[model samples]
Target: MKLKTTYLGKVYSFSNLKELFAKANEEKSGDRLAGIAAETVQERIAAKEVLSTLTLEDIRNNPIIPPEEDEVSRMIENSINERIYSSIKNWSIAELREYILSDNTKSEDLKRISRGLTSEMIAAVAKIMSNIDLVYAANKIEVITTCNITIGQKGTLSSRLQPNHPTDDVEGILMSIKEGLSYGVGDAVIGINPVDDSVENVKRLLHATHDFIREWKIPTQNCVLAHVTTQMKAIRQGAPADLIFQSIAGTEKANRSFGITAELLFEANELVRKEGTGTGPHRLYFETGQGSELSAEAHYNVDQMTLEARNYGFARCYDPFIVNTVVGFIGPEYLYNNKQIIRAGLEDHFMGKMHLLPMGVDICYTNHAKADQNDIEDLSVLLTAAGVNFVIAAPMGDDCMLNYQTLSYHDVATLRQTLQKQTAPEFNRWLLEMDIITEDGILTNKAGDLTIFNR
Candidate 1:
């Protein structure tokens, strides 16, 4: 079977990469050839080319193309990793911050620290970063957090409001965007979830997204919210990196269960920074829900809220540009029902904003859950007053991939017009530039956009 592979993130045929690997000697396996061989091996796994039941014996008899996880490469990687850990293991969080902030330190040094540090270590440093130090070190490492906000715009928090299309149809996406955008929603990037795991599918979705962005000049960035590792692999396979995306959780082990790692997260952050892909500070965007801790079996008997707060700290380490707490997502087991779900959303928002992060609330509930549009609407209005960052604009209040009901486009307009709230600053400027909204913040275009839905 043919497969997609990448060399320096440019996609190529797997057969070609394997041929190159066969010609190369063991001495040339690791940290050479522009990191092509390593990434290609990774891509095949992400593409599901490797059989789950395959073992070393199976590999020996029927070799997988471009051998994976070879000992030579692991040894070299491990040795370097050992050195990075040895240097920082004894350092305190203050010292770690100092090390990051020191003028003598190079960005390459910080990148290495980012790669080698464990999630727990990141959490430790995340908790202690003085607010001033947080901003300073973020600037130093180029880990920006403001994706779409105008800081002094009359206390307006930003939102993402994903109108996720089940089929990944460009038209369906545009249909959803037509409603959400005209409503002054989704100022915070319009990230989508792909129906399939194929990297090609992600590229197709992103390509359509770009066309839509150009057609309307949406004044927003974008990301495909596939698995973190999958998204990273896609980025390596030459997908757009507008915003490196993932779903995060509160506990470290729970995060690992989602296949998220500090290493993968740090790598994606650096890739976007180097790629110069967006108009904002933060590069990564994450969607987290209340019950991931118990879902991963990593809770260790902690309450969902506390573990969820710990998640904010975990997200802070990588300096995500945005994190949306999808409260009430997992159903009765974690959040119990609407009452607990609403409270969870509030608590998560308060904790995230207290950390000075760009936090969004999805204000959603699932089909099997005990909430509905009113529940989401109630939570949405309350969070709006609480100054939470953003909310989803999924069509019909259900994200096809996430299988949960969320805020609709009409819901967003209802909140904004009723409360006289506005979207994040930069987007508001674009709306004014486009005349979609009146100078006084009226959505004069909404009635017009609704005509498309009726058609």
Candidate 2:
């Protein structure tokens, strides 16, 4: 194989870009010179004859040749292609929201005629909506598509829906395996608490998610956060920053995991940007499940940490879904006194401290513990009056569904439908009228051109 390398700021076979430019200059000017320079640059580079030392200063001072528009287009297209492919290889289904919806025309142009579109349309819409650049393209009417939304079983998180968490059984695991094998699941993860020393169990779950993604060709979120955060805290708490960095750098997997998580989160932020076509139904939420509730101090720390998370973006720290029975009080005496309990649980960190993620009464409906139906209804009404987004309703014993009256699935579906009809930059003002989301929902369009308006 011939040795290949770049020299000075350019690549060279015989040693210089100057000679190549000289030969090209003998015959062309204007677009033709541009065309030759554009075409010749690659050959020169490939032949190892590029002048690597060339810098912006070189261009500003010597101005050998202005880069051709075609060259620029080619480079931009290459970069985009690389990004799209890399994203597909590394990201999970949850992560795909921004990428799939990026090319709007791929999604929106079909919406007008799409009676019952296929999974491809759904995936395309999701990808277009999530990718900011693609969405920007759509706003320019160069692309047309809305964000995609499909709800399949989401691994352990979904299993939390079934009674006894039965999804953990061999049969359930096998079913998950089969679905993953068949494409019924997107990214099916099987996470067990590391505290449980269930390494084998964790591996099985990871493989299940991985296999499902491979078989179904759906993207997957790395469920490593729950495990890694806990482990990282233990390992890196007191280690010097340099040491931590070195340790992380020493392994590609270690370094990449953090990067992957950060990228996914950043993508999520971009997808839910304030200027998007439609607003998300749930503005804020608190994730307090296992490690979330430890000591009361631990709970407080989690609350503080979540507030910190919110500072990074739009999440807030708040109580888990609230329920009346959990308070263990009754009647007006119980009701009057328990208000303080619920209030303390929800408002402990809200005054200039951290944003709280309460269940907006419209969103959650729950009956945790109440002897009478009226008692439950009273609490539900109180939650609604308080303007909480998620509420705990125990309509089904033992299996309480996270209910939402204000932000229904139907409402989300409608908002999505509206957004599908509208492209980026185009205002879909009618979304405000839908009342499923907020009036400000479509306000983002004011900033651009392709935006659709109610009129």
Candidate 3:
């Protein structure tokens, strides 16, 4: 077989050290030809060693991403609340201990034993206390939309106030857009509050959202736009939505807002198609508001509903209020609730259109699976089999899986290197089966590592 060899001793075959060394050792050495082969292996091996060292340094120096202010505050507050709750549950015992320790006549030995607070333990507690302060101080809570208020007289004797009209709070509107772009998503989900029982308020929100998209540089194609209840009615009554967002809020109204939005989208698609003057049918979108109190049942229902919509060929956007990674084990009831929903969504049949974007972490994949191992492994493999394309990002999750466009030779090499370092057998197996790698393990393409490969 003809192979490209470089002065860098790039071996064109084999997956890693184990395979490469095995192949080389199987052949005899010492002749000129053997020397060339050995040199090739040695150079590649040297490259591997260099790469491994760099990876170690990279891992060590990898900065812990500063959690978003609101996210961190919520996490800390929730943690502290859980601690307080637990303490309250044992208040009787704690009160008894306090009483015992407060005795003035207690011996020095008894006092020492009862009131012992180790420097290390005190330091740990101090760290946690400090974090709580830092989190709250750094976090800011801001409303996402503007409103119009009517000041009413508290008493008949009081002076009458003029009826106030709904107006846009441009700053607040911009904040949500900015925050969404900065922390939520590159492709954001915009929600306009249209439930104030005022048509003007609905229109203002609509126009504001539309203007936000243009001013904030939020790409039209990348956004999933939604409007609340009154806005839907306004649109139904012949309000212009060309510059406004597609409907979403009305879906939760007493009259079935989702159905209304869906109907309008379909009608809008037909109108444009018939006119042949407007953009085509695919421009329409559906945004669904999902609320769950970090419970397994609630999560399952969210996922189930998303999956159901997907099955019906509808692409639904979900905004989950509570998720597991955020709350962790502290809120077991809520934790189980939200996780169940996520699990069901992932396992859904038509999960492609079911957007499972949690604000907490980004999920990205580098390659398609050439083979499957376990349930999760098979699901990942199936995504590849179904031709799901991954958008490249730095890294996500506890295990930093490099997100790539698709399973390719270069991706294989990168994934292989990562798996090798992490000693993750599942990752290695998936890479092998994806055909992103050669049977022997060499990258099928001329690419090297992720940093270079992405560049």
Candidate 4:
């Protein structure tokens, strides 16, 4: 395949797919930090130009990290429907991008074609797409998964009630969950990012949140964002949990850095199905970000965006109830600023939808990053318009434990009302029953009062 192109009468060439993929990415500090980003704007465009002409087969044949070397690549390769792949193997990335955006292309059509795609192919198309293109195309695909309730239906927006505490204080965490529920959030899950990952601490949070959900009769799931092994141990010791949470990466080595393997995930899946809480199937929750692989020194010279796509490829194998990219939480060293964060948020949502994962975005940033609440709010709106499955919500948009800012309980309520969207159907019914929201899904006068749950 040709890896050279000319733009503005300047010749630009990339040595291989790995280099070309890195250069084709939108400006990201992670790639630049790795010294793999294009040296000039024209060179980046030239890489995109060359990338656009590559065939699906070309990308498949030139695996960024060969299947023989990476289990993630092998899993992604083995997951493709060879029959479907053979039919569209000759299509160029540009044609693939246009087809996704074509008025004639419906959601079902995209779903059918998605079975043929490899993660690399998906990333290639995303690199050539504009921000609006990412939103419009992603809006066409709806991926629904059910753990305690169904999510990702059109006209529906969900929020994960992230009730994190600075010291794993059960009371503090419960206060946040009560506040979030009072605002009609938590349809996705009442997840906690524990300051401690010990099995005992994880079990404590799980049991506390489980008891709260049971007492309120809330139609939502509960999870503690602990390591897979920790959660597995907690569950084995008889802790109640609605879902198991883990952070995943695009490459095997990065996953190892997190102390997870595909086999471990499979074991956790089995344990959750047999010994844990929640309804039939769809019980895994995965969190990912753009720079995780590079942070672990496992990117294998591939661009962060492509590696992000591969995360979906790995995530799909478990049929996770939700998969969200913590877009800006990786810091300025990777995403840089709000513009890049917004672009990555859109890219990840689009790519996950294309991979048919129940995709969401944690529209968040660290304190030191060159962003503020306004930028996060703007991306939240953009993601909402793109039909995202869910977003993480903290009290007042501040996660005291993680020390990052994300969507607040109030922000979620406002987004739903302003966008004319509803929560998951089951949770929506619960909200009305509790007088938290009106029949039309607007927050009722009684909403935002934690005292209501006191009864």
The TM-score leader among the candidates is 4
Local distance difference test, per candidate?
0.59, 0.25, 0.26, 0.93
Candidate 2 lDDT by residue in tens digits, 1-455: 12235545565443233333322121112213223222464543343222222222222223121224222112212322233333243343233333323454343333222222111222222222212332232222111111111111111111111111223343444343332212111111222222232444434444444453345333222122133333233223321110000001111122243342333333433333332212223211122211111112212211221112122111221111111112222122221233322332222111111122221221222333223333334433333223222222211222212221112222222222333321111112222332222433332322222112122
Candidate 3 Cα misplacement greater than 4 A, ranges:
1-168, 182-189, 193-197, 215-218, 221-265, 271-281, 288-311, 314-338, 348-350, 353-455
Clashing pairs in 4: none
Candidate 2, after superposition: displacement of residue 254 in Å? 27
Residue 72, model 3: lDDT of 18
TM-score of each model, in listed order = 0.65, 0.25, 0.29, 0.99
Better of 2 and 3 by lDDT: 3
**lDDT of model 2 at residue 107?**
33
Clashes of 2: 67
Q: Residue 435's C-alpha lDDT in candidate 3?
A: 32
How does residue 333 of candidate 1 score in lDDT?
60
Q: Candidates ranked by lDDT, best first?
A: 4, 1, 3, 2
- Candidate 2: which stretches are off by over 4 Å? 1-170, 173-195, 213-286, 289-455
Please write out the lDDT profile of model 3 over residues 167-278, one tens digit for every residue: 3354544443343222112221243332254776555655555565545443322211234344445556544443223422211221132334334544554442343111
To one decimal, what is the Cα RMSD in angstroms of model 1 from the true structure? 17.4
Clashes in each model (backbone N, CA, C under 3 Å)? 9, 67, 17, 0
- 10 residues in a row with least lDDT, candidate 2: 239-248
lDDT (C-alpha) at residue 233 in model 2: 38
> Against the correct fold, how does model 1 do in TM-score?
0.65
